[model samples]
Target: MNDHITTPITPDLLRGALELERTEHGLAPHRLPVRARAQGDGQLAMAEAQPSGVRVVFRTRAGVVELDTLRTRVGYRGMPLRPDGVYDLLVDGELVAQASTTGGKVLLLDMATGTAETRPGPVGTVRFDGLADRVKDVEIWLPHTEITELVALRTDAPVEAVPAGERRVWLHHGSSISHGSNAASPSTTWAALAAARGGVDLVNLGFGGSAMLDPFTARAMRDTPADLISVKIGINLVNADVMRLRAFGPAVHGFLDTIRDGHPTTPLLVVSPILCPIHEDTPGPGAVDMEDGSMRFRATGDPAERAAGKLTLTVIRTELARIVAQRSVDDPNLTYLDGLDLYGDADHADLPLPDRLHPDAATHRRIAERFAEAVFSPEGAFAPQPVTA
Candidate 1:
């Protein structure tokens, strides 16, 4: 192997991705393309395009692989520092190394003042030294929770993009629950875990604080190539109180319609949100209460609001079941898995959502396991097809 060889970080070397757009630093992998981005709020756009489940896949005989990246870290004033995002390295499909950037810019926020500031930090390089001497496939999974810009790549040997996974691509979209919120690592996100067990390539479009049934997101899904698809809806909508029930059904139909436009026969799974005690019956617009010097979420909407078409997790589940059942009459590929099946009140009673909303890492594991068993079984709607020799 050569002592040094710099490879431009280009789009061709990545997989489980939708689009790669040039950022000021280098390439920013995006789940949503320009068209979808142009139509979303700055928050939604940023979250949706943050490269969850995106990774760089290449083949080489390199002994050392170094990746330079600029990560934008989020911080809250007076709170415990958030850990650096992890970059997982897999060789021949087995995880061999895990890394994190040493330094990057930080976005600081003061929840009390409603003010935010940026602290400039330097770009950092992550090096994974010592690999097998023979040529092999390598995949560097980017940090799922950080906003990262791929600046450059260096290896000891010549490299080329590896072939895409032989397994079908599974495209899934949801809110923070699916975005790896509080996940142990990018590859440990529930969807990631399920994808691994289900033996499918994952394209995670789980946008934290987003996933509001946006037309652009649906359109993006409609245009993307995929063999199987799923959308985990409800949590973000209810928490954000983005829409009333009167508008939700039509919005859902519209979103599914857009996906059907392109994936006329692809098996589509519509997942409702996992059980959150706070939002189970209480209509949302969830509020973060820091009045007691603790950051905890509280259900702000009154249960009475449901009388006027407001949304709650229970309401969403019922509606989603109805919608999927009605459509399955003609579209047999459509399936609905009650989010409760993956996680319900009983599970939560034992697991307990630490934040009263998002699932902890252990809970993420439970959800992933349930999802794999329920959806990837031979009788399941998204059962894996046997590979032909």
Candidate 2:
């Protein structure tokens, strides 16, 4: 009935990815490779496939564009409902329109009962009509919060993959804060914002609740192509209450060592946890304080635990600074960034973290602005080098 050229989506059109695997219905873009997926923790395996900053990019003169996606959505049975993920369409690098699929698949979990269920949905399509006839670069940003599979791509005019240009690739990994916990959309995530401001291509490894310096993560970073890299550590360490002081230092060292094996001279920045007042001096296994329907985080570990080598933000910062200082003696490219520089007490007074853990949208913007200024400045660690002919 209709006569539009429908093109099959393939890896060539995708950006900010390390590997792409063909799925039964579509293509699954992964931040980590198959080998890394097989060896990493279940959380890492799940998080790496979410396509945080990944997008489908191409150059075209199409007057209309349509995208078909198979999204796997997540829902909490008894908790607050998660909003539908957003897809950003950028025309020549500027946001033009936003889209989200209606239905594909849903994974529901009954948090109170510890039961979970999966429901199959349908493929949904988003179309943007009346594009200018001139050739322009188009990017369809995938939802950072959803696990999406690319089904197909259609355009009225022919499309071609755009070869990467001068922009450097930024590979970053961290906790929920880095994962865009409360960020509104994929492109608006702090990492993406910082990348935009810094004029770099982002490969965000900011996996929610899975930034625990796993060797698999480090190896994945090692293998991925990146010009600059950063690892934000500590919050997950403190909140997950996973390691003791005895193991924390070695774990940090081992994680860095694995990355160094692959990126011996790449600009590698080690960032300590941001200012979290509750866990400033206190230890944690953060717990939820469900008051009415609102959920807030509370540090459950004791302050005295620090004396026993339990990790805290203050303690972690001191150790991370020490590690970078010592390593920089031999590896000049290594650098350290105090996470507080991104979000600290003074700024928190003005823009407080709404949930006592994750920053709200406004805070995310502020942090991204600060990150861009601080890390991309001329003297900054990841500053862009002037390109030469």
Model 2 lDDT, residue 268, Cα: 94
lDDT of 2 at 192: 91
lDDT of each: 0.88, 0.86
Question: What would the per-residue lDDT of candidate 2 be over residues 332-358, giving only the tens digit for each residue?
Answer: 999999989989989889988788899
Q: For each candidate, what TM-score against the reference?
A: 0.95, 0.96
Query: What is the per-residue lDDT of model 1 for residues 1-389, given as tens digits with 9 covering 90 to 100?
Result: 25789899877798766887787888888888888888888677658656789998899999999999988887779886578889999998888999888888887878788777878878899889889999898989998877788899999899998767577899999998899988888888899989989988899999999989999999999999999999999998999999998899999999999999999999999999889999999988998876444467889999998999999999999999999999999998999999999999789889998778888999999999999999999988798787689
Would you give me the overall lDDT of model 1?
A: 0.88
Superposing all C-alpha atoms, what RMSD in Å does each candidate have to the true structure?
A: 1.8, 1.6
Name the lDDT of candidate 2: 0.86
